[model samples]
Target: MGIPVDVISLYRKACEHDTALSGYYNRNVRVESDDGPVMVRVPSAGAETMDLAIWPEAALLDAIGPHVPSAPRLMHANIDPPFQIQEFVEGALLDDAHPAGAALPDAVLDDIAAFFSQLLAVPVGELPAAPSDWPKDGDTASFAELLLRLVRSIRDRGDQSTARLYRDLGVPEDPCGLLARRVTGLSTRPFRLLHADIHRKNVILGADRTVFLDWELALCGDPVYDLADHLHKMSYLPAEDERITAAWAQVAPPECRAGWEEDLRFYRAYERMKSAVVDTVRWARLIALAAEPQERRAYAVELADKLDAARPCWIPASDTVLTPDDIERAVDRWSATGGTG
Candidate 1:
């Protein structure tokens, strides 16, 4: 797709110097400007519209500037057009270096642990308010409540294809209450800033240090949640996963380590359910709107694979794990419903 005219105009006005479009996705663009490379992120064109909060990454980068040497710096932003210009940090994505399902090197693991330790130290008072849907600081009930809200929202907004997937999977009617029960009796840890999404793709391995990217999902929550997120998303080997957990326990604050083993299980299950919902919704959209039959089929298969991977994490074993054939049938049914159901 062509880059938006307003983004092109912003690049010209900001640098006046020659600019090269380095990357483009949806409406967000990365341009190499005279000053330096910058990322122009457009909020309206993305899929996360349900989130009502203004992008908090720039404000967060400002607050933690002194402490986090590797975080990208915010250069400028405009709310009128909903564009953010941020310094583009240069480094290989951790996934690019260590592919998914591979063991991460010890050095990388240590750097990641240290990164979380420092992030938790940033005073929440200096940061902007988190997204309204996010749980308030240390409010364990809010954690489960937020997940339940999201599940309900997805069901309400999703079409028949998504509903069918949910039914086939036997997703609980009251996931929030279920999650709340699972997490009850856990010792409450002091809340701190958490990069709620810390997979390999968001970790940039720099020459001297590791820089975290895409703070858009950042929030204030239990620090252990961050560790659980990283462990689940990184696809670490079983042995490596255990070692990394041990390393994090050694470095994480004492309060953060309380009920670490049990809490990780709860967090992992939550993450899996959350991922399943998101993927199912995306697949439904693709089935309805994607013009290419090949593309729709590809995404359906991918989503099915993701659902399968998350099967083990479901609180109660799901009734049915979706297969590629089942997804294709759902897509056909969606088409038959004229994309309305």
Candidate 2:
């Protein structure tokens, strides 16, 4: 959590090895460098192409470069380790400056829509098909299964608090059952390019520019899924949502747009339910640290706050504080005591 400043300076000096080198994750000192900042990308190895590829954060800017001149350009890249040298456009983190949860001004939201407009316009045919490992279960029918698999992955890891969170929340089971039982006849749209993880952290704000970063999860399927991701994570007001909704509508056929909105709502819920596994794991990991008891307890409370924020939209579980006893219950449910990751 703490960064060492001297080490940072030394890393900056790494530019010397390959003058073009901006920097790299974990100094291997093997790859040649370049003059300016560079980006490193690592597509998930041994996986199918449809699975999320670890594109450099800089590429997000590159995606918008034709439309926005001030946006960062990705100069170079290394896919093995997966990092990039981006322009590092200076500005406040979007969440800090636009604290209404990325409730940006009209100009800012327009810029975001413009970026997506460009992205959706490009012919996805040019993009390669996902590798063999890309999850075959990516369609609407597979949604519940995918959520279960991810949850099962988490449960298999055996972190008590996380496991407890699922048992307490009833997870994809509860939500998926509701969808199948209530949200009638949901249709599946084949995959399209998606910025599947479009949270505020991935959007960088500048004085005159707002750049989206982190496109590792982009895949050529289910564009609606991406829209839902952005809306769910950022929670922009109806206006922001409407604008983005309209932008995508421009590229989609009228019929596609009509069905898309309804489907997006479902996927949005699916994403939140699935993301809870990750969030609970995050909290459990922090609580397990050897840090002070106060730190652990503090994180436990913070976990509650995160769940609370996630609840009004998704996360139907009670707002109970996560306690060791809760985890023990999950551990019993999982029939394991460790690594329910």
Candidate 3:
């Protein structure tokens, strides 16, 4: 592990990066110059998404900085032991309890809709086909397998919360034989670049408007996956209105928020199920690595509470409408898993 970085050090690093400050997600001192204020957020690294560019943030800054509109300017970067310093992103994180998903006034929902619509309008294929360390098989079956492994990892560590959620949500035990063949065969097309994890937390509020953060999980494929991600990370309140939601209703030749309502439904179920499974693993890791035993205990308690809250409804259920294949997969997973991913 590297030396612990704090607020002061982050301030210096911000100046070094030639920005007002670095935003949250900086482990080694995140700060910048406001033209000099620094924003720093420190979170644990997940080994699973290591290649997602969790460490050595420079590589990510380099890859995505130019691609996204309204993103923080990347003045400088380096990738020694995995550290990243970027211009601080301004804005408040939308509250999970806030019903407005994107945290905007009702009047602003149309603008928000236009924002995402315009975002989708940002042409793809123009950028070079950048190399990525994306999984060998980026299919649903492979993804299910990854989730199952994560479940097993936590289970082995004596944290069955993750496995239990998978079980309750009807996730299969493992993506072996039949399940693999079936899910893989379902989709007949290719994939595209999707910001896999774009929750309210990953979004930053700006004077101009909302902007995204945490692009490491960015991958090429499935516009539905991106839409599903929104549902998965839905905050308690929505910053959306009819117009904003309706903005996604269009069916263009190259639909940005691609897929029919049914496709969106399928992807939502898939992504939400995966989120529950992963949250458990993440909780387990957080607890296991906590320096203080009391902290670990409290975290476990929080995990249990969260699971209980999900008993009647998982986060995405209200927003998720289902179709046949989605139902079939659910039933199939429930039958096989016996209560674990």
Candidate 4:
């Protein structure tokens, strides 16, 4: 299907103000309205179908608006195509404010903890139910099962390169089983709504406050999983990781922190496994768009770098690691197979 006429009209009007800021999954344009500036998000076709959530970000924002103050307020949304208009949050992205791979400032850490604490306070019973396939609330086994299902779905969808990579890295075919075996003596905690993806790029640092963006990957799961996802995605330095972890512990409810230190390792591993599969699919899509050899090489390098960093987290003792050349070969094979398994 072609772009909707209404969407085109909206884009044309938005373009009058300035150029649209392009992101990997969404195109954002700032438009001035009678009220003020509004951010219009046009999600990529791929992104709209990536998750099975009942409501998109806009709807989620509306449901949680009464409780969460650190997120953008939704003004409008179209459910069919997944387009949204929200209050334009004025601030620098955390990525722009801090250097890459640097530790976040103490003030920023405090802001994050505060936001998360407030978010956790919102009663889960008030929110919409997640799709049946999603992990069940407070069920660590279900969380592990969900991760395995995602991996299996990717492999079954003909992404053999990702499957082989997982195999070579010694990631067990049965992720749920592996998780169960590893956590035989571990305890479970209460689950809550989580902003499953909270990398630096998703955080906006305003003069006096911090705002979080991109709620597309939100989930209802163990709260520690949210912290683990954030820490891994931020790639913070060791000392900074410790400091941030300590800061979160200070503000988080006692139940949220119960056995967190012990459970964090498994969560991090799950995150790494999930990220690897997601990135493989993303890189394949990117490679298909690269018309030049240099562009393809650059994409391969990026994929290799990501895989290398995540290797230890997912499979710490594995002897197999993909070099850039190995990644290039894999990409070539994927491309040869027409990006299928």
RMSD value for candidate 4: 4.5
Model 4: per-residue lDDT, tens digit, 145-260? 56556665654454566556545434445434445466544457777878877888888898767888888777777788788888888888888888777877876778877788
lDDT of 2 by residue, 211-297 (tens): 765555565555676777787778778788788777777766443454776787776765665555456655655666526867766
**Cα RMSD (angstroms) for every candidate in the order listed:** 5.2, 7.9, 9.7, 4.5
TM-score of every prediction relative to native = 0.80, 0.64, 0.58, 0.81
For model 4, what is the error of residue 274's alpha carbon versus the real structure, in angstroms, after optimal superposition?
Answer: 2.0
- The segments of candidate 1 whose C-alpha lies over 4 angstroms from its true place after superposition are 1-28, 44-46, 49-55, 129-136, 175-177, 284-302, 308-319
Q: Considering lDDT, which of the candidate structures 2 and 3 is the better prediction for this target?
A: 2
Q: Rank the candidates by lDDT, best first.
A: 4, 1, 2, 3
- Candidate 1 residue-wise lDDT, 236-273, digit = tens: 88988887788788877787777778878887776776
Model 1, CA-based lDDT: 0.67
Which scores higher on lDDT, 1 or 2? 1
Instruction: Supply every candidate's count of residue pairs whose N, Cα or C atoms clash at under 3 angstroms.
Output: 1, 39, 29, 1
The residue-by-residue lDDT of candidate 3 on 181-210, one tens digit each, is: 334443422344456566556666666666
Best by lDDT: 4
Candidate lDDT scores, in order, read 0.67, 0.53, 0.46, 0.71
Quality of model 2 by C-alpha lDDT: 0.53
